[model samples]
Target: MVRGVVRPHRVLSGSWGEVIASNLDYHRATFRWKCEGLSEAQLRRRAVPPSELTLLGLMRHLQGVERHWLQRTLAGTTPAFPPYKTYVTAAGDEWYDDSDPTPAREVYEDYVRACQESREVFARATADTARIVPNTEFGATDVRFVLEHVIEEYARHVGHADLLREAIDGSTGE
Candidate 1:
């Protein structure tokens, strides 16, 4: 089982950035917890039939999500890793492939790094309001929207990870 990562306590009263960061970190840790103790094969196993989702894929996807929202969207910086969408299958329905040969350990490590980078970006920001993206489908947007969207993305995927993990080995928890 994985160790060393701990979910942070809920911030009942704090600055807006502090509360959002805490919730985001909590969900990120939850996703990692769901995949803990699994072997590479287990991590790659398509536990959810008819769906290409795997623990390793989720790790890759979340890593991209964290970087995309914080580094690209919020900070307008180029992504430091491969775009997760580039791996779209011939079927064009999934971002991850069951046949991918990348080591699961590498995927996990990259995910951790992405999370750290996102946290650093957030911590360094002077204000979320001034960092705005213009002319989006959602119109002008700022880090507030980006942070909320990223947290929502994690919350949804963590639930998926919970189901997939339970299917893999009958394991279940928050």
Candidate 2:
């Protein structure tokens, strides 16, 4: 568990990479805070009827997102995490399927680890570093685009998490 207060990103001024990284780091910490101090059952509770969304699922999904974009697309290699490998082949809502029986601690730990690895990937990349995104209409793309896309993705999901967390236990904040 992260001790003490996790400081908010001071996005006043920095390089392009620093700005994007700070924003990404902020969102990542926000997501973690939203999920803190929840039991396994609480984490797995669905948001609404007929919806599979859960805090646990969101964490798992973000883990996959980090691995796919940072490890696979940017680094051009397979995901190092075995759970993610299983998720890629699992049928029917792989990320949200609570039937997998994996421990909530494992899921949360994977997310934290994946975020750290993603920071490393970004650290090695400059704004202009080019990486070929397979199956995209536009062949090669720059690191800036990937970083921006990650920020956008996390922003959207964190919004979802806010609602889900509030619905679960009435706790909410940025």
Candidate 3:
């Protein structure tokens, strides 16, 4: 488990691909920081009465996001170890379903591992690498586009994570 706030390497100077990767890594670290030192109850706490979002849920959702985009979309194959598959099978809204009794640690670990796998996927790719997102409206894309989209996804979710974390413990930071 991550012991404390992880200082992601600064992206002061790099190629376009390196910069994007660094930014994504920063967001991933921030997400982990937001969920750190929280109990299962706190991790599972919804922000509002009707909202299903929770720190744990976000972690699971992001896991699937990384796996789907990189492993499935980019690599054009299914993830060897599909994150939250069992929960998804049981409930269509597995990411938001708090009913599952899965441990918070497991969810966090899965997310971290998925992020690592995503890194591997990108390491084997170049900014200009041709890619076609199957079953999507867009016919074709490239590694750069996928990287940018993932960064945007993390940026949006990190905001949600900030709110959720604050509601859980009144803690806040980038």
Candidate 4:
């Protein structure tokens, strides 16, 4: 077997692809877990001015991402959950959230639920290299691309979340 290629009909990985995919999943899950236990106001508070990179907003954004990649792209289905257009801007305005102010409990519940749904979708597609759909950026895709991108996206926001949460009340770490 090639060093980076799968054994075919089985998945034993001395492979770059599988390794990266595994790491991606780890980081993505870590990002979600890190935001737990913060309040709604804390999660939604804009730490940096002119930037709405709140933990709640990140949750909503990641929900939209999961819908796009796993549902729309992979499953080829319409969004099962509501779209989070509240934080989306028309253009050049990445930070604009306008959702109803839910209690911390409610917000956390929704975010956690979304992550569960996404996990289901990811698990259903058996192959890491399964080509669910084409992405504009990644172009041709396997599940690996989706997994990696999700991790990348979440990692970026998690760093922001770390700072935001720390600024709120001095709590930190994953």
Candidate 5:
């Protein structure tokens, strides 16, 4: 789905890069598996009443996350996001806020592209080097640290996807 990284499991040129890349691939596949075989309506169907997480919404939010982390941060862009004030909207502001919004397709497209681009970025980042990263709830370090963060994020979401998928349809597992 992404343009930068293809199969995250394929070994690249470096040992560390290969390990991180593999995790990336693993999460991408896991994410796809969680999202498999559902129509647009099914993807957008909410798991519980008054809750803000539909699979479609989750997908949108994932795209937003990629855009922020890779396209914005990794790419070293100054502005973190668009100038729209609605970026502060609680629910669909970042992900699937709109009920049946037309731009959902666009968000998914951007999401995939961002993932691929991040893969390329990581390759170019000289995975052999070190850098400083901010302190997160998960602790802090640099690029390697961030990659670990990315993997954890994807893993957590994949689990969420599993439960959500089960609720959406009786289907489960890879």
Candidate 6:
């Protein structure tokens, strides 16, 4: 498990925003906990057969996901930073493989930074009923929906990450 990842206390009773935000942060920390203390090779190793999944790959994937939702969708603007073309797969998955030569440290740092930026965005956001992507082809959705969707996304991928981490070092935990 990763050090310095403090999962926020569960909000048994609070505003809707508070509860969902806490859950999202919990899943985020769990993802990081699953990737702690691993070397570049260990992070990139394809532990599960017939799967391209890797810890570093997940980190990169989540980084894109965070940006896609909060930075693009929520902020409703293009990203100011350089894109992540070099990290994604040819099939458009936000992952890497044996051919990807990026250092593990960069991937990990990018994820942490993205998570922080997401938190900032969430903090500054308006009420849950506020419509996102108003009048767009994506249809109307609210902040609550997007936040919950991101939480669901994190939970699903964290499960994948849990399996990958276990296969990598034979270690496992919540």
TM-score of each: 0.87, 0.83, 0.84, 0.70, 0.73, 0.84
Instruction: Please rank every candidate by TM-score, starting with the best.
Output: 1, 3, 6, 2, 5, 4
Tell me the lDDT of candidate 2: 0.76
Give the poorly placed runs of model 4, Cα more than 4 Å off: 1-25, 83-99, 126-132, 136-140
**Count of backbone clashes, every candidate in sequence:** 0, 0, 0, 0, 4, 0
Which 10-residue window in model 6 sums to the lowest lDDT?
79-88
Return the top candidate by lDDT: 1
TM-score of candidate 3 on Cα atoms, chains taken together: 0.84
lDDT of 6 at 8: 73
Query: What's the CA error at residue 116 for candidate 1, in Å?
Result: 0.6
Clashes of 2: 0
lDDT of 3 by residue, 47-152 (tens): 7557778888788878877887777777665686533433454444434456667788888888889989888877665445555455363557766677677788
lDDT of 2 by residue, 48-129 (tens): 6577778888888898789877777776667776443234333443444666688889888889999888888776644455
lDDT of each candidate versus the true structure? 0.78, 0.76, 0.76, 0.62, 0.62, 0.75
lDDT, candidate 1, 4-91, per-residue tens: 5577787878998778778888898888888888999899888988987888888888987877778767766776985444455667
Question: Please, what are the lDDT tens digits per residue for candidate 5 over residues 1-174?
Answer: 232333345555568877677777778767766776667777777776676677766776665566555444444543233222123354533334546465545555656676776676666653444765444344445666666667777877888788888888887774
- Pairs with steric clashes in candidate 1: none
Which structure among the candidates has the greatest TM-score? 1
| Native-to-model Cα distance after best TM-score fit, residue 172 in candidate 2, in Å | 1.6
Poorest 10 consecutive residues by lDDT, candidate 5 = 78-87
lDDT of 4 by residue, 1-174 (tens): 001212222224756555644654555555555565666566677877777567777766777676777667765667666533454466744442645555546555565566566666654553546655677767877776676676677778778877877787787765
Off by over 4 Å in 2: 1-7, 84-96, 127-132, 135-140
Clashes counted in candidate 4 amount to 0
